[model samples]
Target chain A: MMRRFPQIAPPLIALAILLVAWELGVRYGFLKPYQFPPVSRIASGFVELSTIGFPTGVSIWSHTLTTLVRVLLGYVGALALAIPLGVVIGSFQVLDKLTAPLVVFCRSVATLSLLPLVIVWFGAGELTKVFLIGYGCFWVMLSNVIAGVRYVDPVLVRAARTFGLHGGELFRRVVLPAALPRIFAGARMALGVGFMVIVGAEMIGTIEGLGALIMEARTFYRSEITIIGMLIIGVIGFAISAGLTALERLLLPWAGNLDAVRR
Target chain B: MLDHDNLARCALRRSEAPVAKRTTSPFLQFIAINSVGKTFAARTGSSISVLDCVDLTIAENEFVSFVGRSGCGKTTLLNIIAGLEDATQGQITIAGRPVTGPGQGQGVVFQQHALFPWLTAVDNVAFGFRKSGLNKTDRRQKAMDLLTLVGLEAAASKYPREMSGGMQQRVSIARALALDPQILLMDEPFGALDELTRIELQHELLRIWEAQRKTVVFVTHSINEALMLSDRIVLLAPNPGRIKRVFDVDLPRPRSRTEPRFNALYEEIWDELST
Candidate 1:
């Protein structure tokens, strides 16, 4: 940790400078407090949200947990369906060609644009939010998984075949492991999609997430609380991606740097 | 402290014994490539002939090399011999049995090492024993033995990416040998390495060949490499690839590049290749 001080110090100094500048701007007549929300107010707002609770009973922890659970459910559901379907589609050239246009069309449709239809189908409730998040995540994850399986190095397959491996045995031993780095890349991308979809999904017919908290606080003219909620969402997003990167490192030490694999 | 010259002489005598055996039974061909040819159909509807009517017969436990320039179909011929690809015309047989497809006792080491990046060195070698009916522990032990043979016992647990290019090739050789096949097919196995590493691996391969005598069919672009390792060097020509000439290298074992005979053979092969 001590050896990393040089690398860590610059980012810390920059963040401190930015916060101080923002705080001073609000203190003077340079920036409006309602729009910018002074650092001190946001900090105090964070403390109140955690302890005194937002809208009487729901704390910041409850809001964060609700958002996390919703994201996890949709993300997991999307992956569960996407992976197997992607593998089957990727393995057969005929299937891949047949579904290419359909997949592209579905993935192109905006997630939030389907809000009215989803609300009609599932009613504006928890089910509707989950369905929307799943929809956004599924197509991205599915496409990535298909590409992963399809683009496995031909040399690797040839080497395996020389060992007499073929059919399911070849797929299990060589193709699947070769495609893992790509699959993990897809999972990370899908999670980002799921997170983005949930925030928008939570804003509608829900008063129990960080997104809902921001929307509710803005209506009550608590700009500080809104800023605080936004900061929390950023923190959650950063933490989740970092956690995923760590998990990828632990699981796939042989994959080398994932940044090279991410396309 | 060791008598290096005497050891070389002993190795030379052993190597020469095969030549005498070959003369006695010239009809006993181990691997017979009968009019083998390969052609690829291009996107423009024109068929590209890579190899044409190539005929060569390798004796059992003999070291033969196919040497030529790029587009000479040396690797194409090796792939056909390895059963990874089929010939457009003709056929290849091992010990009188026609090769239908890959994996009938033919082990190949590719130029790129082709070691599965996900598996460690030991596991990669053990993969060759998938059909051996051996338990996991036994297979691992056998893999370790092969690694030791290639002087890479310490790198048994290392992944392919963790090892150097030379070390990866050593692991690849170990994996190929783990199959304990009747013949070993190598396509420029050390072609990507530096000159010094390539020379060192050439010696290492010779040592392995002496220890485990198998019919070795090696493909290389280097005439010097072919001269250094093979008993007979089959020079191939490109543009509808065909054999130009076959040179018998009767040099002694532990052969030096500085030797007059070695230089002469190199010049002869070079002269043939230039035309």
Candidate 2:
């Protein structure tokens, strides 16, 4: 803990200085109050968001929970579909080749660009937002899962073979475990994609998420609330990724330094 | 002291003699490499011959070494023997049964330690017992025994990346030995290690070989290493790799490098290799 003090102190100090400077700039009229809300206003915005609530009975906690639920649903749905499909596709050369162009085309189509089409299909509801998040997360997760399974080191496979491992036994014992680090990386990346897509999806229709809160705040000219919503999103993202990293460490104790495995 | 020149001449004469005439007992001919040749098709549509009509016989428990420079197809020959690769023109048989594919009682230790990165050292070793029908606890105990043999019992739970290069190779050796194979085929197993580690592994390997009494076919670029460990050294020359000469090392075990006979044999093999 003592050794980490020097490393941890600088970042905390930098953030404090920036916040103080921003507050002073707003108070001194150096920065426009409407454009950049002072530190005090943002702090009050936080308190008001939690206590008195935004718009009516919907508090910041509810908004955060709503966003979390949406992201998790979409992320989980994407993983459920992608993982088995990816493993099967990656195992066979012909399947991988056949789907390559289609996968690439779908990934390149842009998740938000399909917002109008999705809204037209499903209407401006929770399902529309969830579908958009799933679509965005699916492609990223699928590609990563496929690459993970496909590029398992040939040396490892040959080593397994010398012990009489072949076909499904090889796939289960060697290939699956070897592909895990990459698969976990895909999950983390897919979650990030889901998070990004949800914000945009929420902005179009719904006033119960951080994305909707910020968008509504902009229309009401409450820039402080908008800034608070943005900060909450950042905090949520950081917490989620950190949680995932911890989960990965817990599950894959043998996988040292996951970054090294990521292509 | 024996005359070095005379000894060299005698060795050359012995090598020149026909393979069938060299051995007296048919029972000792455990492995037969009958005119084994390998040809790989190049990307440009031409086939490149790697091994050309190579024939050698290994006894049941002989410690033989194939010493040659790079591109000499030493590793290729080892792979062929292991049944990891096929010889386009000929066949290799162990105990009179033809080698069709991998897992034919051949335990191979590669140049690079190929331990599964995700598995612990003990788990990696236990991977060899997949077909043994041993219970998990029994398999683990057996794996621990192999790890102990390789002097890596303390590192049983450690992952491959957690250990040093030498330690990883030790685990790899343990894993290969776990297969309980009839023959041990090593392709420059210690080639990646530092000099000290390499020497240490050489002694360890010798000790293991003495204990296990398994036939070993070791490939290396180092003549001194071959002199230290091998019962006989087979020299292979590059283009369409074929045996150039063979030397019988009759020196005593725990052989000293400074000894006159060891130096003489090293010099003789070095001379043959460079030419």
Candidate 2 vs. true structure, TM-score: 0.93
Please provide, for model 2 over A17-127, each residue's C-alpha lDDT reduced to its tens digit, 9 standing for 90 to 100. Answer: 999999999999899988999889999889999998897789999999999999889999999999999999999989999998999899888899999999999999999
DockQ of each: 0.59, 0.65
What is the CA-based DockQ of model 1?
0.59
What CA RMSD would you report for each candidate? Answer: 8.1, 5.7
Error of 1 at B112 (Å): 0.5
lDDT of 1: 0.87
lDDT of each: 0.87, 0.88
Against the native chain B, each candidate's TM-score is 0.90, 0.91
User: Candidate 2's error at A141, in angstroms?
Assistant: 0.9
Q: Residue A158 in candidate 2 has what lDDT?
A: 85
Off by over 4 Å in 2: A259-263, B1-25
Mark the regions of model 1 whose C-alpha exceeds 4 Å error after superposition.
B1-27
lDDT of 1 at A231: 77
lDDT of 1 by residue, A103-148 (tens): 8999999999999999999998989988988999999999988998
